[model samples]
Target: MTERKRVIQTGWNLENSYARLPKSFFNIIKPNPVSSPKLIILNYSLATSLGLNGQALQSNDGIAVLAGNQVPKGTLPLAQAYAGHQFGHFTMLGDGRAMLIGEQVMPSGERVDIQLKGSGKTPYSRGGDGRAALGPMLREYIISEAMHALGIGTTRSLAVVTTGEFVVRENQQLGAIMTRVAASHLRVGTFQYVSKWGTAMDLRALADYTLQRHFPAVDAGGNQYLFLLREVIKRQATLIAKWQLIGFIHGVMNTDNMAISGETIDYGPCAFMDTYDPETVFSSIDIHGRYAYGNQPHIAEWNLARFAETLLPLLHVNQDQAVKLAQEAISDFTKLYHYNWLTGMRAKLGIFNEEVQDEELIEGLLSLMQKYHSDYTNTFLSLTFDTRWDVALFGSTEFAHWYELWQERLGRQKEQKASSHQLMRSSNPALIPRNHQVEAALEAAVKQGDYSVMERLLDVLKDPYAHSTEQIDYATLPAISNRPYRTFCGT
Candidate 1:
């Protein structure tokens, strides 16, 4: 018998749509190659979607390309320049430790950015070492993939590679690099960059380019910039509403981290809520709870406002008229966000129709969850199953009252009871990337060099809504000892 040998292809169909912009938009730079490149993981599913051969990508030659040791042919790499408002203060910042290697044009005609995060230092290093620890790199890989599975708009991870070196964080740790794929790296901060530093023409050119790339349906009629602003608001509204429905906290809501494409970018310090609390905050730097679970919608609108400011020059000829138009667009954010949030909340509660009392019922359940400190995901998941535990979970009388009201609401729906149950089941996930589980996975990987735990967690999270008796432990909440929890930015 003859053994089958694998064939490797080294060709990549790379494009540089972003590089076509003026030279001031970005700085061309090369990634600093690592000492010893080691493949941590390769997302075969994502690779296939990007029109790349997964088997070829895992080859020795491909691992070198992923680790910054070798650049793929026809790839033009550069670090993008953008300014952002960090914690309410504007500052000039860019791709400090990341580079856009190239754009992959999929077979379906969709284009996505291929970026190497934590690759090496560039002009935007900001006097810091351009490296990333293995733990945080793995965290982004796990959470970003989990987000995609949950049907949320987010940047996907293609591969993670170890640098076979050490990086200094709180202490020395193993260095790594993450390959991030996104619709585009354009951000609200990118607009702010041109608005603050570059000329008016630069801002207009960027707006036009962004429209052509992301929102092409919007014709360039009079006041096209204003139309662009409204479109961005709608995307951000829907994206943040999905986050809120799942009790996901973004942790860092800086303008730079908010992608103009409206997908969730930058997984630093992000965590899913365990107990139901509107004020839940896991990011250690969010001492003021500015970007807390409940504050996400408001923060999103604020970020969009900063984005709008960048387009003021193009919004209208007169400065005052531009401000008026921008204000009107910004004012629509709250209504759009509330509508999205309520729509998702209805689906989670198995309510298929609109009713004025729907908001009250949703708030009532949440208020009870907060009062009892009940598990958020579990409480919602339980709705799709037996109700015997509900009495004990939310207290006998309190849950009975809400349950009765909920049943009456369901009775009013035109859809059958079974259909509502299915809706609820699909909307509420049985498992999330729990903080304790994530920490445990990271610990095993960093301390014992074990990746099996992470692999198992990813397997369970891949089907978040499905209930499997054997994988039940992944749905459980963390012990009390893991309380008073906090997450860092991994800087």
Candidate 2:
């Protein structure tokens, strides 16, 4: 077999961004050196898709590049600046602990941002060592991969490199860096950063650049800022709806965490629920329950308000007119989000068409699921074959009555029985990276040096909807005793 050669682009596009603004916006710095860099996990498949040789990824140089010990030939390392609302308090937060190494124009013609998480300190470091603990690093790798498998748009982990050092968090913890890939790391807070600095010109320039890059169709129009605002709202709503349907809690839904590209970017303090609870929260620091499961939609609206506020200056030629236009854009978010959420619920219930009472039927099913404390993913996946979701577990013969209601709603769908069944099965995943399973894998890797468990979990997570008898263990949720697995920010 001819050896597949590894390809590296010779130079970077080196596109300077908002960094052209005041120097206080961001502090430029290189990543800190690690004692011994070793690959804990490598996403070889993602590399191949980005026009890289799978074999070359196993090379020592590959580990060095991934560990942030050496920048790639075309890489441009810089920290992005942005402000975020952390724990309901507006805070000026930047890429304190993260660095955008550069942008890569993949063979597929898509430009992906190559970033290193836990790459060391920047101006935004806020008096802390910008290092990541092993548990949160592994959690991001697992959950981000799980999101991709669940057919959601998200940041992808390209590789994980251990620093061979300890990061002091809750206790001394292993340190690691995650090579994260995203369409763009531009967040809603990026706009806010410029807006608050009395730099409307930069904001407008950023908006134009963003529209051309992400929303090319809108680049030709008047009121393009409003167009970008509306489109971003739509995508974000759909993304949040998918998160809710999967029983995933983002834990931190800060405005800064909201990506303008509508991708799930930050994985800090994120967790998946084992039981159906509308108010479930898993981030140890989210004592206020602000970013709980049921509060996602409302929080989304709040973030959109922040985005709208940032865009108001460029949204309309007149200042007062701008506020009105932005308000109009913000208004579209709730309707768009609820529509997407309802449609997702319809598929979960096997209802494929618009019926006058479809929304009620969907709500009825959710109410029963909540009352019974059912597993979210399993309940949805099981509806394809059987609507009878463990009546005994529901603690009531009333589940039988609810199942009958579900059947009646299913009967109204436009698709025939077999087609609807196929649609439901395809849309609902049979597996997710259950919290317990992820914790178990992380424990083995961090404590026992057993990465095989994590490797196997990734394999199972890749084909989430597939029925694999051998991987039956992957389908079960964490036991009741392990119901709410807490996630953390490796502080």
Candidate 3:
């Protein structure tokens, strides 16, 4: 077989619509240069989407750009300023170690923010070394790409490069940088920053610009700020529902990490649940279990409440009336969330028609899973195949009772069995970025300098719903020894 040659482009087209914002919004800071920069991996598909040549991005000059040693022409690199509530404590937090290189306007006219993560220290370093270790950077690359392949909205890793530097954490480790692509870096915390520090004029400008950029389709005649709040709530409702359906847990869901664009932004300390448990908490820092698996919907509501407060001034002339308006919008979060969540659950169960009893039926399965400590992904995948793991719940009288009811319900739908089966298969993935599997890959890469595991994991994750006998091992639950696994924040 002839070896296929890789394509290379020598030029880049970068724009800076975000840089056009007032200087108060961000700091014009350059990345702290790294030593011995070397290319590690390039996301060829993502590069192509952004009109970048993948082969060039892996070259020497590209390594310099990725390592923050050189800035590409037409790029305005800067660190964004934002405040967030971390572990319920309000504090000022910015890009400490990351910088936005610029935005790329693709041929489709969609603009994406290109940022370098773990580049180096910035003004917001907060008396800490603003550098990233290789393991965490690679973790983000693996999980984010997996999320994208699963059809979830998320910031993507465009490339990863080694800095040939060392960072001290629990131990000394090699440093690295990851290039991230997102719709925009605007977050609920971005509004919080302007509201708490910037002037009312600044707040207004930010609101107007956000509308122009993200919600241009929103009707401008009425209260646009309120419209923005409603839209954000709707997107978050849908997003969180998807998260729950997939058994994914975002371990650190602080306000700053919640992107206003509705994409899953920060991937630090996130994991996919193996066993079904409502109160599962993985982040080592989540001592209080504030951001648990079941708490996600509630925390999402809480974050939206904080976002609503920032828009109160723009909501109405009278503070009292604005409060009332914001409260009304916030009230819709539960209804919207439950509707989206139940609808997704129905699809996962292969139910084409919804009835009043659907929610009860869905909750029953979840309750049984929790009670039996069943594997989350396998339980759903079993149902898709018209079979059950005999060990989990299939043999239980209660589950059999529920199964009878489910069968009757499925019979009522006009859709054929094959159609419903297809829906169930697509709705429930056969694979996820499992915590144990991810750790194994990271250990191989960081300790043995073996990236083959990471590459193989990515190959299976790219088609999460497919059934491949050779890759069936990826679908199995982790062993008991790997139980109660904890994830840590990248910082």
Candidate 4:
């Protein structure tokens, strides 16, 4: 017998709550129509979750919408304006190459931003062409989906539409647009924009709107802005901790890139660490390693402090009292980060109970990983699944000692061995988007029009916790390279 199909329309339930805000928040504009619109990839799962018609989005009309060639019926396309601290210098920046079409209200009544990246130039284009290259768009799709699968807080990609044109980066590269879905595109820089140039009322209005949208639980009265600051700090603390736990490096952690929603925002120049070195840096622009693997927490705190500064006018009536409260809230970052990181690391090592030695045990393994140049993901993975330590990295005497301590600590916990093992498995993914593999997949798709590589990568990435045979092909160590691997922003 044949089964009936579930037909869905291409209609997206879009609303423009952001557009209702004062005009300073965004510029009302439509995306620049692309030359040719082709829907190369569609995340059917994400599409369905957003109450969209997955197949209908692949239709001619849908492809046009996805490629920014045509605006959807319900969306109010606009470009956001904000300022950010690039590197360490403060500068004005915004969605120069992107437009937030509108917010999609889902079945659960949750609102999310639907933005088209690489759509075209905006008033805040900053003298550069507002376009995106195929490779970077594909990279964000891969890494962001992989992050979501790995249970990390991140901005997700719903589709990738090729623009049948070329964007000049280092060389001529095929242009593409990625549909980025986020809780909202609110950022620390968003607050800074209003605080620096906007009037006192402007700052309060943005804060009140943000508080209601992102943190409605924050009390309406009685220092709600300070509460908002605290909430953002807490979310960012845990978010950075999760990134560190997964050996993921954000690469560019500018204030603008720091999402107020606490999801990892931009994916430019980002890569997962193969080796466990805390000092690992991959972005070609990060000559100083400001956004290195280990520095994520510090950068998050710094960004939060900048965010706190913006809330000072709303934090308290007395300037001194406000400063004290913000400072106090900011100081909790170290403790919050350490607690969150250690809690995650404990699970990665199959430990169910906390002890004084727990932090030391984790640091010991990390130190050994750095000393032996061990692969970060695989090191924990070996303990989670593999019993044998035949590999030279774990064969060292130091690792052996650490192993004994770990085992002893595991025994001391109340949970059964099976429970501990299960936790470890759930905590540590068997696979990550390895840098070399990701580059190869990007090259095949962008240069040769071969998508099978990316398809397989995405397949294995979907079920990262399970011991699937297909994952083995992608889980192996990245090929040794002649020089340091570098990633570009592809701006």
Write the residue-wise lDDT of candidate 2 on 260-361 in tens digits: 888998888888876788899988899989999999999999988988998887777798999988888888888888888888877766677877777877
Off by over 4 Å in 3: 1-11
Candidate 1 TM-score, true structure as reference: 0.96
Candidate 3 clashing pairs, residues 3+ apart or interchain: none
Q: Where does candidate 2 stray beyond 4 Å?
A: 1-25, 387-389, 393-395, 482-484
**Clash count of each predicted structure:** 0, 0, 0, 0
Q: lDDT of each model, Cα atoms only?
A: 0.89, 0.80, 0.88, 0.89
Query: Which residue pairs of candidate 2 clash?
Result: none
RMSD in order of candidates: 2.9, 3.0, 3.4, 3.2
For model 2 the local lDDT of residue 88 reads: 74
Poorly placed runs, candidate 1 (over 4 Å): 1-8, 388-392
Clashing pairs in 1: none
Cα lDDT of model 1 by residue, 1-491, tens digit: 11112212643567898898889999998769899989988998889888888877777778887888776666789999999989888999999999898998887899999899999898999998888999999999999999999999999999999999999999999999999999999999999999998998788889999999998888665567888899999999999999999989999999999998989999998999988899999999989999999999989999999999888889888999999999999999999999999999999989999999999999999988888888888898888774544455556588889989999999998999989999998998878999999999999998999999999999998988777774589987788774588999887
